[model samples]
Target: MSGAAVDAASGAPRRGEPRPKAAATNQQLRQQAVDRMIEAAIALIAVKGAAGLTLVDVGRAAGYSHTLPNYYFKSKNELLRQAYGRSVGAFRRRSGAWRRQALRAPVRDDALFSTMLAYVHGGCADPAGARAVNLIAAEAVTSLPGLLPEVRLQNERMLALLQDRIEAGACGTGAAEAPASIEALLVLAALRGLVSQHLLGVPAADVDAAVRMLHGFIEGGPAGGRSAA
Candidate 1:
């Protein structure tokens, strides 16, 4: 009830604020706090990169006491790790169903095209998560050695999946100009580059054009029916 006391250490309520309603149980409240912190961390990583993110920043960004993040996550590394997982989860939730279906079947060239299109669009659907993933990925190489293995595994899995799709669909159609392995790496690299450029303030129209160009190249054109150079 509103009259119930919220523990001071919980930091769930500020001075004079009504206690959480009875319908919001303590477990639910705790989960809400953790989710908020994770989202705040993602936003911070999107803006400032994960290299310098602190638990205090996460707590404050989430509108909680600066110590609350530490109470929940303990360390910046752990917080960033969880934030990364949450970002990945959000992307999967956005586009996982069709992707799973596509990967399981013998996709045609058009299906592969649709799958690639979905990958690009899905990455942009959650701008915060996309930017956070890119920023965190950059940090993994230079500033966050502890995150290297995890980041590497994430990329390797993606590359492998793309290659499988390319082999199963595009290569079979003779539309692919390069080896499936090479095509997969190129597609993965292009996607990453597009995301990085967009995060660096590239105009959306230009980014869209580049995506179209990527689709064109995959379909045997340099740009939507033009011959390749």
Candidate 2:
């Protein structure tokens, strides 16, 4: 089985040299170790919940001694904060780039749904980042006292961006639901659910079906509805 952390190039590890996943890379990956630590921390938090995580556990999970994380991060809270920030920052970057593409293309079904599909698919592709985001968000919903205020501010901005883009694309198209903010929140909620299933050890086939269902609904295809009962 492939490692949970994606390979830098092929997105899955190669069969060559061992992965120097700690903060010991050369000039190119000076932050590779740090990145791995964040990924391990994210995955652990997803499986163990926020309060169950510890610096020692995070370090051991990242394939290093328990003190490795301590050298880089002062505490578990700091590590979680940094991991959450990095995840959101990446999403913002991807969404911004997609929005630029949307600016060039017409806001028709072809453009809008394609962009949204890619956006959703990207998260599914990067499982570590997706798990981190959902776990951090879940943590915030229950106990946000330790999370940084900037994280909340970043989320607000992201939601605003989603809503604004939806409004722009749906202008006169009559496709978007009322209150674009609510629609945006719904989409975001679906993404959270997607990540939740993955972290909870759901079957890959089922997870793929969920992603497909979301894409279908976004593209005006059948939602693949099933009885909840």
Q: How close is every model to the real structure, measured as TM-score?
A: 0.73, 0.60
How many clashing pairs does model 1 include? 0
TM-score of candidate 1 on Cα atoms, chains taken together? 0.73
lDDT, candidate 1, 12-123, per-residue tens: 7776889776697889999999999999999999988998788888889999999999898888888888888788767766666656665667854365555565566567
Candidate 2 — what's its lDDT?
0.66
Candidate achieving the largest TM-score: 1
Candidate 2, residues 4-83, lDDT tens digits: the string is 44455465566686765666447545377788888888788756776678999988998887998988898878888887
Q: Give residue 89's lDDT in candidate 2 (0 to 100).
A: 74
Query: Best candidate, lDDT-wise?
Result: 1
Candidate 2 residue pairs in backbone clash: 7-11, 22-33, 23-33
* Per-model lDDT: 0.76, 0.66
